[model samples]
Target chain A: MVEERMNTDKMWITMGPQHPFSHGLWTLRVHADGEIITDAEPEIGYLHRGWEKECENRTYAKIIPMADRLCYSASMTWSHVFCKVAEEALDIEVPERAQYLRVIADEICRIQSHLMWLAAVGTDLGNLTVFLWALREREFFLDLNIRLCGQRLTTNYPRIGGVRNDMPYYFERDCMRCVERFETVGLPEIMKLATDSSPFVGRMQGIKYLTAKDVANWGVTGPAMRGCGVDYDVRRDDPYDAYGEIDFEVPVLNKNNPKGGDAYDRFLVRLEEMYQSCEIIRQAFQKLQSIPKEAPSRVKVPRCIPAGTHMAKIEDPRGESIMYLVSDGTEKPWRLKVRSPIFVNVSSSKHMVDGVRIADVPAIMAMIDMCLGETDR
Target chain B: MTEEMIQAPSYEDVNKLISEKFGEKVVFRTSTKKNVKAINEKRRIFLSTDRDTILELCTYIHDVLNFEQATSVCAVDYIDRVQIVYHLTNYFTGIVIEITVDLPADDLHIPSVALIWEGANWHERETYELFGVIFDGHPKLERLLTPQSYEFFPFRKSYKLRGSE
Candidate 1:
């Protein structure tokens, strides 16, 4: 009976399109032998709305609002990238005030997006306290979003040449306070519960590890790539907007560590990134104070873009998000292609969970911070 | 070449290397936009090559030039011909090279670079399904966004969206 049991063939186990850990409509079919997974395949595109084709119909200005819908958690960066590409096509420059404003808004979005991911990781690991605390902290950042832009999630704030508007009266004070509170109070509390907890660390410490070589080969970006000791960030390496002037550390896990690119390392990298985001916001506010209050934030741009193919890349909360715009000297774009980071990162799921056990799949995959909106689009 | 040049070659050096290797077969275009800011943005290179030489060109870029990542592989339909663009980036020098290959309407097949960089696998698949540009050796050239059985290439100029004429 023992010999027969050992000789059983591998079976394929399907997870999601609706599973809780998936956090979106995508399936992961795992080829497993009892508990250990031999291979994995990710199937996405449930949220595909033909986003690229849709852009071809709309004018340049109208596309900014639609870009916000690409990712629910980090909507600001999506719209910023769209506007940046349009600005590139037009060969225009953003005003100084708008550049600083975009930087602050983007860092806030990064912190909040990472918090959202932390909350998802909590659910995957059977911890409700982390989920609740992370979401509660994320609320403060979303409140900042509402104050900057009228809406909360899909911020139609970034315009073609600049931002929609300047920071409202005393908006900087409130933003600074929120960042400080989160840094001092909100972060410590979450760290105490999650990172400081032995059981939580034990669950994530050594599972689903990847090497630096594997990460580079598979085109993983953002914190996931940083976790594997790849010291590249689009904001720092390929600077855009006001990011070139700002100084901040890109946290990367040391490859020498045995648990270097595991779920825990990725978790640590994102958490540290939140702290860095707070620092970036603080510096951006300092720079904003020097610029004249009445400086023009948004510039007037032509309705039609000249015939050109331009690309703009930004450091999104999840990864390096890029927009490739091909204009045929018309009001409407000829073609607009989005190179979403999650879409590429998710392709390497098989390598991510190759030798991991079945029960560890969710925790391992959670490090990706999967956002299907951008992926499917 | 100096040690620093070998490790992280400047854009000019890489351009020289490619130009020397491929000569007149590849046409180079540099895109530089005027910016009002004090610190100007870097210029990006766009190299247009025939589809026949893209595979070999990619191998040199990966092995010799050390462009470790294929940031994107996308196809644009020109109504007359299809253009496939591959954006490859070198992490060390932060240089991005945009390679474009035009395939005539009748011949939409181009060799795949997914084997050279595994990250490009899905990108090629998406381009195949949407633009109907066949990547000759793509490991899995299946539908990425649309249903597998969907016959139309929605991104092509011929296949119109509902609201667009």
Candidate 2:
């Protein structure tokens, strides 16, 4: 009876288009042996809104607002990248003040984006306190977003040549306050709840491992790639906007640790990145002070772009976001392609989660920081 | 525990090596826009090659040239012909070498580079589904985002978008 009851065959378990751990609408079909996941396949595109194809219909300027919708959490960077590409196609330079403003806005987006990811990771690991604390800090950054731009989540602030508007009254004061508080008090308190907790570390440490070679081969970028020991940050290496002038350390997990590139290493990379973003914001604010307040922030550009192909890339909070623009000397674009980091990163999920326990799937995948709006777009 | 990373090839070195290898078959052009402030615009490199030897050319780019990442794989429908564009990047230098393969509209078949670098797998698949450019030798060439039953390649210039004449 005992021999007859034992089963030898492995089972296929389907995770979600609607599962709680997904954080978005995507399905993961995993081949399992009791508890260990042998193989995994991810099915995305549930949030597909034809983002690339739609850009072809609209004129160059109209797409900036649409780009903001790509990722709600990092809306500033999305719009900034679109503007960067259009700026390249037009072959124009952003003003000195605008470059600093873009950098400040980008770091703001990065901090809040990582905070949102932290909140998601908290709930994924079944910790309510971390969820609440991370979200509370994120609220202040979102409020900063409203102070600079008119919108909270979808900020259509970046224009083709520069930004939408100059800094509002006392915007720098408010931004500096928020960044300081988050760096000193807000981040440390949240860290005590999550990073200092043994249970939180226990759930994440040594779970889903991807070597540096595997990361490079799969085209993973941002914190996920840095977590795996690849010291490539577009902000530092490529240096679009004001990043070339600003000085900050990019945290990589492989520096001190021999066994890095696990879920926990990725976690540490993001946490350290939040701290670095604070430093960047502080520096950008100082640089802005050097420039006159009357200095131009927005440049007037033409409606039509020249007939040529141009590309621009920016270090998004998630990864390296690139845009390719093909123009036909018309008001509208001939072809526009968005190289979303999450799209390529999500494709490598199979190699990431393989051989990990089924219960640890959420923790491993949460390191990816899935934002379906960008992924599906 | 520190692994040795490959040093990225400079733009001059990359251009020289490709010109030597492919000779007259490859057309090399450096982007020169007058009075541009962005670094990427002045530094961008473009290489035009035919679809016949893209696999071989890309293999050399990947294996010999040490381009670690296929940054993007996208297709453009140019009415009479289709252009399959692959942007490969060397991380150490932050340089992107864009390779464009011109395919006749009648035959949109090109050899897949997914086997060379697994990162190009989904990019090729997405290109295949949206533009109907069949990437021959792709492991799984199924529709990624669109409905499987839909027979139209929505990104094709011939297939008109809704509310547009």
Candidate 3:
């Protein structure tokens, strides 16, 4: 009976498999009653290349590059997770120097990714300043990546047990300089743009809130949870790599956000995270210096990984990423499973966007930092 | 290796507490065979429970143990039977407890934990499409990461690879 009373024009509209606001290839079929969204359904797989299935065909070492392709914005961390899993599965001990180096690479990737995300978020909200300014700083780190790893985006840098190369000559000075600029100059400007403008704050502040309960129930992690004032970071809690030795604070919402984590708090979280990432790298560089000069950068890994089921989780800039692997006593894995954070993060949008204006959809969606490369994988 | 005595700081306590609290409901509990004390504490816990008891167990884990998120739902095809594994974690403690519910080939159905963890929704759908496991209570158990019209379970062992005969 209610169905009969509904407006004839009320129907499900496909937002995008190719919408400008969509960061990647995915569609959102939102059921709306005029401009108010009654329901939202996210559809992914437009970019699905079957990364997990493909991993079965590749050797243990060969899959490192494949891992990088999962999330290009933060490729180092994805590959780092795989390397950590493979290392644990093989029972190989990574040297202290290598662990410190891996921390340096992963934290640098984290900052670059957050900047790229801030840039993408800026572009979505029609704020060109954030977009340009964020990337301007982002390029600095990208170049530092080239200096450190010889590639820009998909750096197949971290080998199974250790890094491919040690800190290059002048790496410390160059990296510290980038760190200082990001903390002192680059981040302040972005935060100012986020804070100063009424239009930006008007759109971002109060609406599209996901509560702490929702973050927990949705398995949301990274900036998404911290935005809601729930402090959780795998670097500190799980302490993989040199995160145990590193001292840093997990930043949360200082905006007195009562509606849980809104788009703005998540924004603040990422901004502060960029600062924290710098601190980690700065301390790690000092630790890197204390290590003996003759330390080996790469450790020897066996040609084949033994048969076993293994799981490892890492805090990606997007969220908590976990990989489940089953090896069949061979060079190739029997089954490889990726628990991409974007997949779960996107799913919760159904609840996230409800009761909001149709126009606010893009604003809410982009804040979760959707990387469909990881999601569809 | 220069660093010795890697600290895992009592992850085993979580497993022990869960078993003591929900022993009758749990079907099986096991950890990593890696056995190196440092690695052992970071060991993955595999808990088995029947379809009837899964929802209850999930509620216990989420409500009581504070494993706030259902990180991923993994389905594995073992030829004769399929195993549906739910990796749940307490972000505060980094305590990961993976709950597995095995379904025979004839009955590829299990109760969905989506009711407990909203994050499990898409994960269950992805597992459903790739491994052919039916998540009975999932509100929308649709295929993700594949063409909507694609009919094959490509991740299953039955799917012939290009190099295979």
Candidate 4:
């Protein structure tokens, strides 16, 4: 048997604006001293569509549809944040039932988004089975979204004061079924695949660690923060929509993170969060059943919200998503700013990928759940 | 037995503490009600200050007030002046504090908070290109969203392009 040794040659390597391992159209340029990464600089903006500037030109109603494309996998959450901001800015009220419906839509969106993330993680680690299974499971929720809003990925369901559409006729039954399958069957399988024996675990177990202090400094949030053993979640901390009325535990690094934070811990945090999303959806579904059949789902928004400045934040599946709006005394906005969580998350990569194996970079980046649509916006 | 409940310091209490401590350095402190109701932000306080006191104030915001991170930095052009906002939050206490400072269009420069908040690096760069608010002392202030060679303040109202009036 011949044993090969690592050759410590220094060179710069660029991992795509078009590499399979790269999340989106972002390039990660690495300084590789042999197989170890000495330094890395992440380059983004391949997906920048100037959605914020476009929002400046369009009326508030027009912007909701545009925001749906901001994070296509989790469109409801982005649209919901805008709706709340507009509602608050306009001083409009969303009825109790409408709020509850928004909660249901948002949670369903959360599960689907996380499943897509799970698939991406699996693909990054070269596990095609998990990727296939995760996406297969995601279809149930995607189909449900279509039934409710007439669109799947970019539903554009959330309007200014409330949701645009009501729950479909059999949505109650369909949601319960999807929730049961994802919780009981789909999640357990993913866990087995992730936690069970695989050579990939050695690559992910103790690599690309981010300390709690580093996470706080970089404003990292969502599963990445939870995986680092700092248990803070915006849903519980800053309750929006029907979150105040719901009950769910924010999952953290329940595992012994001797590495402070690891790719596997992020994997576990996301897996556990899926179960919690199921719990929230179940509770919201029960509350949703009691609403009157003919209750109005959306209110009439004025062409322009009263001239004011307001900032709204929500716990996106990725992290803390913020939309700050300043309305002039006109139909169009004076200014609109979107603080993309992934942009900040990706910025921390120049530090994270430092001193890591060049091989481990893909797995490390995957754990952060990079979606360039929002980051580049 | 009923428990003697402990409550975190109220927003007004924090506001008063800030007022007494910072005094006139604060250009204004927003009322606790509107600030709190802004997304049910229980621990956040909004304050505006001038550029001269910004670096000193951000040091106070970081070292004294214990803001863990600056989540976002953006500049809004009001035609007359560009008002930049830094949204800082403390994770442990679940408190968010928004710091605002204005720069006139004629002199659009403010001391960088990037020195305090590492996450402000890309944000400051983006704001520089888009709104032309130079973050003085920012180690590498270049175009983030736009190309490196590009030099237009696209987010500013004055930079009108070919398409629209």
Candidate 5:
């Protein structure tokens, strides 16, 4: 004889598709028992734009613009990645001076991108002051981008085998000023607002803890993996562009070290990464200043790639972005496959959200910092 | 973790090993244009065998050749035949190997490698749904990343898009 059990009530809460804090158009169907979430299911494809199909229709030159949309914040990086792979398939060598300029533009983009993430994360946490401060500081980097490429977000600065244009005489000086300001004034205030605040620390610390083993197993990269204490940074491991020539450190948080992998660890990593990016920019800027301003920044692209396949991997701010190019000896590629890092990083969201409070979801998701454009591309 | 431990095997060694490991079953070998000197050199190997040997080849690749990660699994459709391409990469060595099996367009069936590498689960499902390739032994073989009610295999050359149709 079995005794009858009482049916505990369960409430369904939907957070996304239009929510301000939610990343892109993802809808979270979470089952809650009282205040705690018992189960959660992520519903995607709300922001799918069929970029892959679109790529097949466009020429190689035209596809760079679409790559810009994939990760809008990191437009130059994606464009560079796409163009680099295309160039590799064509066996075209990018000029040394052009590579330096590319590095400068990419580093500037990284600085602005991390600033945007900081602002968004702060805004999600209801810290309007920090958001304003971050955006204010970010304007400096945006100005530099405007000076270099004439656009802020979708510059399409990177071209196949080179850049769209050369930098102005004032570019180096202006970039140096931005880096100096970031180090001396901007970063300290942002750090104080984020890490020093008890409320922010309480909301972030120990929440969404991903082990290093799990990070590698799932092919996770970038800050998400660094947040799990994995010291694997693609720039250091697989150098491309001017990264091999530049001097910068790969910031990691080990349990034995001062910083342990957590939301705070991720925050700390990005903070340090900004400084390293600045250092890279300084080196690249110095290199660029030495080169003649009249030097050609664009390469003459061949009509068709050799009949074969070529794959190139670059460390974008997100993670390891692999672009696979297959040419059937035609002007257009037979098949082009982009192995986006956000796709792999976004897969770890399930691990991050487990056992965390419902309110902290926004913070955790923001900390993961996945660009839906890259994920769905 | 050390570079010396991760030996960068030449293309000749790779071909010889494949020939030795699976004597008659081994079909042909082709080289990819992309080569990473520091990492494992990239190569594409084509295997012609029955459906039964699919699992055995995958096992041998994973267990012996040390193709630890399954990068992607995609199917390409030709006029009369379909080909399933398994793109595998070794993490430490950075070597990429493509194993392809050709099948008739009428009967596009191949065994799944999901049991060996869990990452292949979604990829195989995607291939199955998009190319209409049937995987014989895929656990929980369901449509992934696509709508449940999606009627047509959109990826196949024969399946035309809205404008083309």
Candidate 6:
């Protein structure tokens, strides 16, 4: 007797929407051949809240909170980007001292953001110890953030033309202390735990390789592009804030390093980047200290922005975050468009995860360091 | 090449080239603010070139005028017409070129420049999906970022959330 064969074409596996490691409300429908991902489709909009449409309806000042929700982890970056674009649209000049303070806040946010990325990436790689250590270091910066802005994550601390609040009395000392601690104890421990682990290195070293050409072609930026041998950093290339006046190196892979463009290179690059961010914060703190104790934190501008379009790009921890603001001489902006780095970075996932095993999917996605909130927004 | 051999083309030279080549097909031209002092002479030429002449203009901009990267594509709806703006930037020299096309609101169609720059593929798909502008001869002209079954174009000015429209 011949037995009828059951259908065994393509197996659909649900990955997220409730998974512990998943960043936000996103689901992955994977078509696999044993362990190989033949086709992968991302099902998004589960977390979508019509933020763009909401921005159009709300006043410019009211949109700040919504901007914070764009990338919850790097909330300051979103607020900074929004304020900068609004300032440009309004043609308002930020004070030199205010710019320096903005840099301090921006760098602190970067440190915290990279720490969060490191922790999340570590957690994804099964190195729970690294996650705890990284988060511990991250909390240092978050504490500083809370002290300054009265909130931990969504600190709507930036406003058009300047910051919402002046630097607190303990700002300089606190930032310097954080930097000293990061250099002396925090970063080294993270390096030892993450880089020295055999399984972590083996899991990340040569996996999901993206070339410099691919990086440019896909418009991938930040650490992911830098991981693949691209020397472009928006901070260095397109200077904003006091980044132009400051002295900090844009860390890329050493030319002599054999495995220059891979997951290992990216890990090393971010490791070095944390150090660079520390140096920037220290310099900014010193600058802040040297400035007069009483300087106006906010700039005076007309209520309505000049009738035109303006675009501003800033180097967020994730990548080059761009804000395009269109104002028609109204209290509210005519249009506000955000070119989020994660949106561009995540678009290259199909190219990155083609031949990799199913087990490697999480690691690859983490390397891209996508924030679905930003992407969907 | 010597410094004289690589003489930087003035903004007028670039503007003159577009006018001389495209003539009547060109619609508008304007200059915008740029960052660098060295490229102060640079101008952001906003041209509404013909759909058939897009590849030719893109090639001319790349090979001759030397705009290296296709920076961004912005789609705007103006009630009766949909305007698609291609913001192109010269990588080596920081010159921005804004190429625009206005299609009627009823049947918004333009030729796809995916053949010229592969980066235009996704941007075009996004524009098509959001503004209902069809790119003729696109490889995979389907909805991206938005779900396939999404009935209305969200970016359109007429598109309301639930009850407003």
User: Which model scores highest in DockQ?
Assistant: 2
lDDT of 3: 0.82
Candidate 4 per-residue lDDT, tens place, B14-115, comes to 577668867898855554224225434555577898899888777766665567778899999999988999888766566777878888889998888887
Give the alpha carbon lDDT tens digit for every residue of A321-374 in model 3: 888888877888888899888888888888888989888888888788989899
Q: For model 1, how does the per-residue alpha-carbon lDDT over A140-206 read when each residue is reduced to its tens digit? A: 9999999999787998999998899898888988999999999999999999899877877888988
**Compared with the real two-chain complex, what DockQ does model 3 have?**
0.48
Runs with alpha carbons beyond 4 Å of true place in candidate 1: A3-7, A255-260, B1-5, B36-43
Candidate 3 wrongly placed segments (more than 4 Å):
A1-9, A254-258, B1-13, B21-44
Model 4: CAPRI class: acceptable
lDDT, candidate 3, at A164? 91
Candidates arranged by lDDT, highest first: 1, 2, 3, 4, 6, 5
Candidate 6, residues A1-377, lDDT tens digits: the string is 23356555668778887775567777766777777877776655565565666677777888888899898788988988898888766656687788888888888898888888888888888999999999988988889988889999999998877888887787777778888989989999889988899998898878877766556556677887777776667676556778877899988773334434777787788888989988988787777767786878888767766677666667888987777676778787666767777766666666677767888888778877768888777
lDDT against the true structure, each candidate: 0.89, 0.88, 0.82, 0.81, 0.73, 0.75
Worst-scoring 10-residue span by lDDT in model 4 chain B: B1-10
Docking class of 6: acceptable
* Model 6 iRMS: 4.1
Model 5: CA > 4 A from native: A1-12, A31-39, A255-260, B1-104, B110-121, B134-141, B161-165
Q: How well is each residue in B39-89 modelled by candidate 5, as lDDT tens digits?
A: 332334445555667788777766666565566676666648887777665
DockQ of candidate 5 is: 0.23
* Per-model fnat list: 0.69, 0.67, 0.69, 0.47, 0.01, 0.06
Error of 5 at B52 (Å): 5.8
DockQ of each: 0.61, 0.65, 0.48, 0.45, 0.23, 0.26
* TM-score for each of the candidates: 0.97, 0.97, 0.93, 0.94, 0.85, 0.88
Q: Which whole-number lDDT from 0 to 100 does residue A149 have in model 2?
A: 91
At residue A16, candidate 3 shows an lDDT of 91
Residue-by-residue lDDT tens digits, candidate 6, B1-165: 111221235567777877887888776654344432222434345677766777778777766765545656667676877777776654344455777777778888888876556556666777787778888888888876678999888878887656432
